[model samples]
Target chain A: MTEKVSIKRKVKCALLNILMYISCAVICLMLAGIAGYIIYRGAGGVTVDLIVNKPSLLKGTIGILPNILNTLYIIIMTLAISLPLGVGSAIYLNEYAKNKRVVRLIELATETLSGIPSIIYGLVGMLLFVQLFKLETSLIAGSLTLAIMTLPTIIRTTQESLKTVPGGYREGSLALGAGKWYMIRTTVLPSCIDGVVTGCILSIGRIVGESAALLFTAGMANEVLGIFEFFKPKMSGSSLTVALYMYAKERGEFEIAFAIALILLALTFIINALSKLAAAKLKGKGSGR
Target chain B: MKRAANFLEKAMNVIFTFCGFIAIAFVVLVTVFLLVSGIPAIKEIGIFNFLFGRVWASTAQSPSYGILPFILTSVYGTVGAVLIGVPLGLLCAIFTAKMAPKGLGTVIRNAVDLLSGIPSVVYGLIGMILIVPFVREAFNLPDGANLFSAIIVLAVMILPTVISVSETAIRSVPREYEEASLALGATKTETVFKIIVPAAKSGILTGIVLGIGRSIGEAMAVMMVSGNVANMPSLFKSVRFLTTAVASEMSYSSGLQRQALFSVALVLFVFILIINLILNLVVKKDVK
Candidate 1:
């Protein structure tokens, strides 16, 4: 009886180990398959011409220069607006807020915002920015929408980093007669730069991958908007993801779609690397503090 | 001079306070806008009919708009994705957190991060070409872009969140518990599944809930693969989720149809709220 029980236990343990190893292999293989297939299929179509020129019916050329630049513009606009609001909120929550209940309420709101899907953000952006604010379906409106969507990410990351900043730094700054805002600016915020960078990278990842929110807020016009043309009437264009959607779904242009996919995959790789570096830096700093 | 300095500080405080209020204000604004825009159609069409009636021929002359198909599709897709994703993700999490060598772990972690960073549309595009065809050939069906294809794509889309969250949870399990189990002659595998995982139950639950939210809210990926028809969900049948139901029509929908799309969004919103509330409870426990 004792021998049989031990054997049964051995079998169960072996099966569990197999389960663990198989799951790991499955995950790793899935990743390998996706990366290999996308690169092989997509890289062939990513030509210099596709990267540099814009589509023109007369010339019959398809390019994504405008989409790439528009992506940068949206990134700049979203970060400009959301970073301040999110960081300030984080500061208020972690450093300055007097009422615990108010802090909890704000935290809950931000959590809800993080979980709310981008489609709803798209609709709200359409209603609020495009219609109510009278901004057309332009990059400006799209950026504002993305800014709202990314706020929770920035705030949460910043709050986390703020929490890691030692209390001694703030108390020391205060002991030297620094005011609250001054102490935060000089002492608290500096240590949390890596957290802010991580947040920015995460938000950029979301923005780069985003399509549903921008579709309604930023109409799919592929023309490049100049500096002066921004915030003017009808300065609308597709980002790379949205362009990929239009190419594959609307235009039946698989070559161009694959080209865009290749670019996006590269961007994803870069962003993931940067975020990991930022996270590692944060960990090192956090432990030292 | 001192009064002026104090006044400046107070003004700065007020500005930061206003900035902090911005998030709460946006939430209120979205909820109010969704309610204001979404209710009129429900009142016009009757709530019961809108939520539960079977057919959804929006462009037909008669134009019946029951969303039973969409709601069920969303629910079933989320459930299916969770069923496939959770176990695979849990095992992978255990491997990464406790078993893998340091070098292998970093590589696997990076791969998972890359998978997470890929855009939903890219996933959709790949699925449209690859999985759709594979499904068609495997099932010997005329079309392969059905609920099943969408579920597969969603499962992959959700893997990173599951793996990352559960890995964190499992890693945080007290080492002492595992040590005690091993001291008593329990195998490492038994100590992990039977002891460590049970201790991290709440965290793993939160991760699964987060995946459900993601699967239900996914639009572009599901849209590309799932045939954009309002059919009740079956494993092999083409179906439209609530998200796709709104997205496929929102671009050119007019008058009552447009309002009805908002109503669809409202339903999706409520489903998300319930999920968010549960997620909050789980995460709150983890924090404590």
Candidate 2:
């Protein structure tokens, strides 16, 4: 009876181990398959012409220069607005806010904001920015929407890094008679700058990956727009993700879509690496301190 | 100099206080806008008909605005994704947190990060090119873009969230639990499965909830693969999710149709809010 039970247990253990191995293999293989297939299919379509020139119907040329510019403009605009608000909120939460109830309320609000999906953001942005504010389906409106969406990410990261900053630093600055704001500005903020940087990189990743939010708020007009044009009302421009959607879904231009996907994949890779590095640096700093 | 410094401090305090309230303001603004815009349509359409009506022809001559199909599709798709994703993700998390060597674990972790960072549009593009056609051929169906393909795509999309969260949970299980199980003559696999995983149950459940939120909220990828049609969902039929329903027709839709789209969004928002509450509860319980 003991021998029989041992054989059954051994079979169970072996089967379970195999299942775990297979699951890991499946996940790794899926990642490999996606990255490999995209590179194989998309590498050929990525060329100088595709990157540099604007898509012209008269000339029958396909390019993503405008989409690229739009993406850059949106990123700059979003970061400019969200960074201050996010960092400020983090500072207030970590440094200034004394009332735990108020802090909890703000934290819960941000959590709810993060939980809300981008499509809802798109809808609200359309209502608030485009209609009520009369920004009129422009990149500016899209950036405003995205700034709100990314606020939670920035605030959470900054607050985390702020928490890691030794309380001694603040107390020491106070002992030297430094003002509260001055102490935070000169000492606390600089130490936790890595967290802010990580948050910035992560927000960029979200902006780059974003599409559904921008679709309605930022109209998908693939035209090369100057910097000034980005601010003008009704100046619609499609980012690369939106462009990829238009190409694949609307135009059936698989080659162009694949090329855009490849570019996005590359961007995702770079952003992931940069953020990982930032996180590692933050960790190293935390331990060193 | 003292006066200037004092004034600067007060000014900065006000600025930071205002900034801190910005998140609260934005949340209130979003809720107000969604409610203001979304209510008009629901009132016009009547609540029961809008929620439970089967047919949805927004552009038809008479124009029925029922969203039963979309809600059902969204529910079915999320459930399907969770069913496939949770087990696979849990197993992978266990492997990463316990079974794999440090080097292999790092590789898997990076891969998961990369997967999460990849844009939904790229996933859509790939699904359009690969999975759609493959589904068609495999099932001998007339159209490949259907609920099944969408579910497959969603399952993959939620993998990173599930794996990372569950891995963290599994890792946080006290070392003594595993050591004690091992000392009791149980095999390593047995200890991990029977002892460690059960201890990490709350975390794993939290990951599952998060995965549900992601799957339900996904729009672009589902929009690309799921043939944009208002149909009662089945495994083989092309159907539209709540997100896709709003996205597919938002461009040219106007009048009541446009308002109805906002209503759909409102419903989606409510679902997300419920998920968020559940997430908070789960997290709070875990803390305790």
Candidate 3:
């Protein structure tokens, strides 16, 4: 009887482990299925001219080059605004803030901002950047709106990364007569580079994926809107996700929509994979250094 | 020289201290902006009517700010998503944290990371093609898009966040608790449910709150699957949500109608903000 019970226990544990393995496999299969199908539908239209030329509603003439450029423009502009402000806010939250209540309030605010619906951010952008500031529906407005949307994520991630750095590093730098600001610049920031980079990459990924916020703030004109056209209303452009959404909503052009989706998915996957690679390399270097 | 350096240091501290308050200032300013734009519309609609009215017709002349219908629909959608998402997520978490083989855990984690990385819009597209069609055929419904469709797509979207958070929480529960339970003649299933789950309740709660926020604010995907009709709530029938209402109509709206849409956003903002604050407090207490 004792031997039988012991065997039964072993079998149960083994079955539990098996259950875990199966669930993992199933989840991966489902997610990968989405990526695979999008790529499958999109692969036939992968041509150089298709990638570089202007988008045409004609049967097979939908290239994403201009849309890609718009995505890049949005990303750069968003990072330009968000990085300085996010890092600065994180620095204050981690290093300079004294009152616990103040810190908590800031935390609350950031969390709340992160949770705000993207459409709300779009409305705010429409009201503030477009109507109030008279920036119009330009790339600048889109980027700035996205910058606000991404800011909470950046600040939270950066603060958490900064907090992970040992207090001893700060103490040692201070003891050496370095000013707190100097110490943060030289020691704290340098040590927290890996964490900060990961945060930035994640934020970039988010900006690239964002749509609803940009839909209103940045009008979905497929023109080659240059960065210098920020002051003009004519240079409004849309990011890849928004472009995909527009294409899909256009309805009749199923192939064009599918192709754009494929490209968008590919872009998303590549960016995410690159970020993962950067994170891994940075982690390795940090440990090795 | 030491005195001069001390003075510089003090000044630098003061500067950085002020910088910290800027973050607080950003929050306050944004809140003020929302309130400034939203208050008049709220007043016009009447606070009670806005909160409880069953219909949502926010035209320029006879604007009805009754968010009560959308609020109920949002709740139904979120609850449906949670019911599906939380269990699947918890099971996935259990598998990864306790069951998977050494390399399998890494594979599953990476898969989840990739899933989380997929934009919500893409998820919307996938749902439009796959789940909507499947549900339409299976239920023989008139419209493919409805609350049920929204819930399923959201369930999948929230799955990654839930799994990752719940996994972390469950993993953090000391192994000894499980070991003790097992040593006392308990099965693995019994131990996980009775010992492990209870211990990780706070972490699981945090994940639930995060999922709730994600679902509440979700626009792109839900906008696609939800029928985008502002009417009485039915699982099979089409409905509109606060996020959907804002996204669908913001383009043509002007003057008071636009302001009314902004007011809808403010309502969502308030709900999510309250949830976030409660979550942070719960986390802080749990940490303590």
Point out where model 2 deviates above 4 Å: A1-5
- Across B110-227, the per-residue lDDT of candidate 1 in tens digits comes to 8888989999999999999899999999999999999999999999999999999889988999899999988777888888888999999998998899988898999999999998
Residue-level lDDT tens digits of model 1 in A178-219: 888778888999989989999999999999999999999988
Tens-digit lDDT track of model 2 for B1-288: 999999999999999999999999999999888888899999999999999999999999999999999999999999999999999999999999999999999999999999999999999988998999999999999999999999999999999999999999999999999999987788889999999999999999999999999999999999999998899999999999999998889889999999999999999999998998999999899889
Docking class of 3: medium
Model 3, A27-61: lDDT tens per residue?
Answer: 78898899888888777766787668777667546
> What is the Cα-based lDDT of residue A245 in candidate 1?
95
Which candidate leads in TM-score?
A: 2
lDDT tens per residue, model 3, B1-288? 888877877876776566556556666766788889988888877888888888787763666667887888888989999998887788889878876677878888888888888888888888888888888999998788888999988888888889999999999999899999988878777688678989998998888889888898889888877878887678988889889888998888877777778788888888888877888887987988
Candidate 3 wrongly placed segments (more than 4 Å): A1-26, A56-61, A230-234, A281-289, B1-15, B59-65
**Residue B211 lDDT (model 1):** 88
Greater-DockQ candidate between 1 and 3: 1
Candidate 3 lDDT for residue A184: 89
Write candidate 2's Cα lDDT for A28-51 as tens digits. Answer: 999899999999989999999999
Candidate 2, A147: how far from true, in Å?
0.4
Fraction of native Cα-Cα interface contacts (under 8 Å, chains A and B) also present in model 2: 0.84
DockQ of each: 0.76, 0.80, 0.54
Model 1 stretches with alpha carbons more than 4 Å out: A1-5, B286-288
lDDT of 2 at A9: 86
